[model samples]
Target: MKKILIPIWLLGLAAGCQEAPVEASFAASETAVRFVGAGPAATRTVVEADGTEISVVWGSDDVIGIFGRGATAGNNYPYAAAPERNEPSQCTFASTDMDKIFKWNRGEQAFYAYYPYAEDADAEPNALPVVLPTQQMQNGPGSTEHLAGLGVMKAAPVTRVFSEEDPAPVGFTFRNLFAMVEIRLKMAPGTAVDVPVRRIRLLSEAAPLTIGAGTVDLTAPVADDPLDITDGKKEAVLVFGEQPVLNKTDYQSFWLMLAPGRHPEGTLALEVTAIDNSTCTTTLPAVAFKANCNYRQDAALSLDEFVPAEAFNATAAVTECRVGEPVVFALSGEAETVDFYSGEKFHQWEYADKDRLEYSDVFFSFRAQMQGGAQLHPLTVKVSTDFDGTFEEPNILTAAWTDVTTRFTLPTKPWTANNGPNTLERYLEEGRMISSGEVNLSAYYDEKSPYLYVAFFYHVDKYDATLKNSRPGIWFTDIMAVRAEGDTRIPILSQTKETVHIVNGDKYAEGEAGSDWQGTPYEYNGTTISPLRMWCVNNPPGDRDAYAVTNKLERKVSNFGPDKPESVKGGGNGDAPRLQLRVCGTGNLRNRTGGPEQDAHRRNGNGLPLYGDGKTLRS
Candidate 1:
């Protein structure tokens, strides 16, 4: 229910009347009317015979001749209308109780008849008591959509009624949002009865707290919108009044856009208010309206989040792919932009003035031309934009790899596959390895990240960076990871779901730097990258470990070598370098141990393998 609470002066219900309830009670005995109470004298308050609400009113003198209390004299004691059942009329002293009481009825020139309270007379739907018939169409300027009576029969058929010989009140009801409200009005004869009210407002729906807390104001700017005002065919009708004028038919409208978590009511309200002639201010009723109201679904979107899928679909339709394709995930909402990316890389990668995976899916198919004995190769893909702030959220970087390792019938050759620019695939020719329907590629990257990540809406595709590089159409299969590149010194790293493969000290071009949280000094510990303890004391003081140089050119730590771990009673050395080294049978001057002979390396004892072609090295 909609309720309005304000100072009494605000309501025009009593217009110029100043009399209070108490004043109305004292003057009740002055008129011919008597205040009747229901119970004993002490507790009795005036009541209608039907037990409904009773007011100070003069009662019937119907039994005057039979009772003898001045029978003839009591018959016409005061100014009362003749009663219907041949009984004297009953009336409320309200007609004469206050000075303004009589003044208003005179000014309003209205004839009011007071009767005994009638029970069950409240607004019961079945009663159908004749109330004010209000629906009136003003034979407007344009054609009305309801002219043929196609939609509804509306309030009444005979547009307007005049009180020529008979008069009565009529009630009109209309739709305002989800509410149906009726208003009471009294129409008189020959008044023309067509008063065009300007503005009409209906009470808003009850505010919901979860959608918000208190009342929020939603301003629906009403202009001439065809869909709302007319049936999508008519121009909007402009109106100006404290009350809204019902179109030739039945419609006034309210439409608006609002923010998320916002609802409006109270001061920011809608309703038909009584307007003054000059200033045009008016009183707004708490219930119902003379004109418009509505609720619309799916009216707004938010941009506070990321870009939504609809936006990406409109923007990033994976036209091309090399190994695997990117799966589109929509984060559509009322957000200014909803963003959810699987490392949301560019589908069309361009590099060196050429485009890879252009006009293709995630994974593209390609044939490889391998040279003899070139088993290892580098697989690089070009991307457009980067959202991986140096690849933070990802533990690995991967690409959607097309299983390009599709080998044919047993080949006559037992050669290695090189991942050079020309070599796309390399593997053993004879065995089930070819029929496994999967590819175990040995691709190298110069970054600390996994190769590159790929996610596909479908199954695996054959990985062919060369195909994406050479062809114009390649589809993305799934996402694969590669370590991210940065100023990382660890290079030639090839990692998969299981182990991390690396070629010692791989290098990249001048600007090819990225990072992987699991690379170098840091390792993934479920949550964040933590420093590896082995790199804690990269260098040590003198006598920390005895290092020896060998003629085999293999540097071995004499102290922390095999014999030392054998004597100590521990599962394993906590900081031991789990690397194996061996010397050629015809040792090329292998030494017990050798590394960069810098003071820090010697003193700190952080030594690893070193080629004699160079001196000492930093591990």
Candidate 2:
């Protein structure tokens, strides 16, 4: 629920005059008294600076008489008669004594007035209703200070003098001698429940101002009055009991009149009694009640939604799973394979496999299964940092290569015939069949060599023996990276074709390398194929069984220098290597030869020494 409290000022007239008199009468030319405010109705309106409508009860019973200077107990002349009870809007005053008609001389004059005139004209004739500073007025007969009801005083001094030559009637605007307070209660929006309020009360310690001829002193100090009416009243308490709150937008308004001074500096306690004999109390911050100013306080009640306590289970809430739940995925249809280290483009390492390095201590984890229950093949992971863009002179691979196969590990168990039907359930039962590994390339990381490359080496002998010239499925799923923190795992590859796709091996051919080779076209599958996927041929087909290996795995490069020590780098702590690379794939050999692999024992296009024995090239 939203609650807003805004204070708005009511403009009171300092001086004003009635419309031009139809008859030639001095009384009609006299200034008329009025109040103006922002309320929709005239009676509810108070004085505001920009208001135009006259107060409905200006000269009615609500506001009885007006007295000018020198009009005291000893002299009753120069005063107006009681406001016409029948026509409250009437502004012109009437006097019975013709010799002492109320007249405005050619000079300034001041006046004071009170509401609910005194009935007894003899006892304290000029004493307006007054109360003790700490006494609370209740709505009852004993609360009255005099025959007049609750008193509200206002004093207005007309500074502009009136003259016979002036054609307009003079005007005098009055300002309140007491402070007006209004309390508003509302329900929060979207609240469907109802809160029945039996009663609402506002309690404050207050006292009256000193009223004198043409002046009202609101700042006067309060004095103890033991002789004052002492029934059961203690402090000023305005009680509004049994109000209905029907809907979210329902609201209730209550107004009170208090002495023209700041109340005691303390919370104004508001007690709300519910229909069930229960009560809720809320306090508002201390406020100052300045004379002639309107103070509005708004409160909004919000109801909390109901929730059953019995539905919570303490045991299950704190339980933690030690073993990771297995995720299963499938790969179907043709798998595209691209050669990484062959042609001029491959020597330049211009492919989608290159990426900017962003994490330290990167770990690659996945569950892989070879189709037809074939034994898992050995895989090699390597990293490099010196390969730049020049392919004409220094071959890309000759720059540097670090074999990181020892960083990888095989699963605990191997695949068995008896497994569950679903992918997840089957993988869990045959979890040992999956192979996972980590590559810590922190040593290759440096600001001078901003880019790091990664590659995978599949044994040519194993590919030729198991599946060659055929798309034998090799399923990989749940391929993710663990950064510096063992717990922080970011997904790098997914089994779904849409998330992971093959880099067609033929696309690595010399002239075939286009803009698509530089991390663009492959992005349509949702993930960018890094430029590092350039393929390399270890030995020509004539010398040995040709096998293709994945190449050019580059980490995300940084334009800024290496991260500062003790400062956060990328998404991990800067103390360790901050970069990760993950590659997942399926299917068998789509062998390539020719272009740069014709001469054996010679430096190939990648500038790597070629040997007849597969072991020399593999190492």
Candidate 3:
């Protein structure tokens, strides 16, 4: 079962309007918390953050619950249940919201903030309903851990995401933290993004701005951490910190969130190296390129040690690609051999679709050939929702120009909720759903989750010719999976618009246990070749026109919710919609090469996982 939580603000075309400071004061004096973080041992030990020793747990390490806990019953039973509802709760390894605490950062003296994730992965096109904490928390120690009271403190807006290019007022102080510091924050296309960062100053002042308790201005020393980000148009990280400078050198990024207006007193004089004035130039790499050659992998994870030269590699999920431009993809590194095989675009389903769903019909086609004396595999491609009544497409190997411009038909059939057919919901172009008022699902892409493939599906209709195009025409590959390199991909479900897809939020790390380390496999089928079947039963293309379509996402059933039917909606409106789709057979993805873990494995084009005696990719 696949599990993902989509922050409402992180989804939709326009972000949930910049979060204004909540005025409802949550009295901190009324809060008290008995913190207990579980670990790898059976003994539930108490932690310093909470100052308690009730129960210490290990191995089953997990943030049990926050907010409140149930009390006991009998006076001496020692197992009494508390009565009092504590709605919404949080369990995170990122963000200053201690509720979302990950592994504690010993060095920084803060929570290992997992924050959100910028995503681009192989996931289903379904947004599970947002489930907030309703079960009353056990009123105990943790009731006081949160910065409750003072109402939701108004967050200081981004200081200077985008300022006059030249003579941008910048300065630097010192803090040895931050293993990686970036200058520019990349923004999704169209969406207005701003650049927000901490103030870096070398000079100290007597007077400083007091933003919040425990958090002061330059008046004293730097106390703020993690920099804030504005909308789009942020400075890019030209330098990833070559050497540890702070303890010895004179460099540091500001930590406080600066308010609008100009420089505050005592906080003027910015540094140059700390600011990145680099312009985004389309130099068209010295060599031809592929947009998304590096297949989608887990974010918050590392290939080799860190990641591929680039994290996500998808051509279909890009917003800045120039039409006819040569998009290049650099997956981990070196393919053993171009196997020219089969691939699974979809995976098994958790929730059944009774009331069929809808989606955009996208066609994929590519070819591999030698280039620059290196086994260069340039698989240029393009896509469109143009699903003409026609079915199978012709070979794209014989192209006139080397670019991603191959076109095909689209699914124009009228969208029927649950006509016993597998297909995608059309852009209704009306109110309530995909309408003229607010933006549709597509609008959220590129800008929100910049690099990701949005899949579409409808019910399986035997009578509809379009439904029987390939497999069970019900499901189809609408777009390839992808997301911005910086954002972490998260799955979400929306009923207001009847839409679902992956969204890019912040950055994250995949669990070492859940990493795709076994690698992948591939094989030969007569003249037709393909990859090892991980998610589907393989059926060689009977001909260039025959292929199988499968949902490759590892979906989670628990995500459907309690009201969901015991069985997935197989043929009704209450059931979840399903898609029947296949991959284009013109590429080497079919017969993929072998991996250290048997099946074809993906290598880090950028080599990480820290080679030599490594355990999984975690090695």
Best by TM-score: 2
Q: Candidate 2 residues 1-619, lDDT tens each?
A: 1233333323232222111222221222543322111111122212222222223234322433344553211222323423335654334334434654455544554443333233332222233344423223333211212112333433332223445555543332333444445556666678777776544555544433222222223112211121122232222434333345534674565445555443454445554544442344555556655544445576665544211111100011111112122111121111111222221221222222354334345444444444322323444555567655333222434556677767666433323464212233443454434566555555666556535544443322223434341222233444444335345554433333343223333223354321112222233235432221212232213111111122223334433322111111111011222111111111111112212222223232333332211110100
Which regions in candidate 1 have their CA more than 4 angstroms from the true location?
A: 1-200, 203-369, 375-619
Ordering by TM-score: 2, 1, 3
- List residue ranges in candidate 2 displaced over 4 A: 1-63, 68-90, 95-111, 121-127, 131-151, 158-170, 188-192, 205-236, 239-242, 263-266, 302-619
lDDT of 2 at 378: 48
Error of 1 at 456 (Å): 20
lDDT-best of 1 and 2: 2
lDDT against the true structure, per candidate, is: 0.19, 0.35, 0.19
Worst 10 residues of 2 by lDDT: 310-319
lDDT of 3 by residue, 324-376 (tens): 23223222221212111112121111111232222332222211111111111
Q: Residue by residue across 397-447, what tens digits does model 1's lDDT show?
A: 332223232332212221233221211111222331212222222232112
In model 3, where do residues sit more than 4 Å from their true spots? Answer: 1-584, 588-619
Ranking by lDDT: 2, 1, 3
Query: Which model, 1 or 3, shows the larger lDDT?
Result: 1
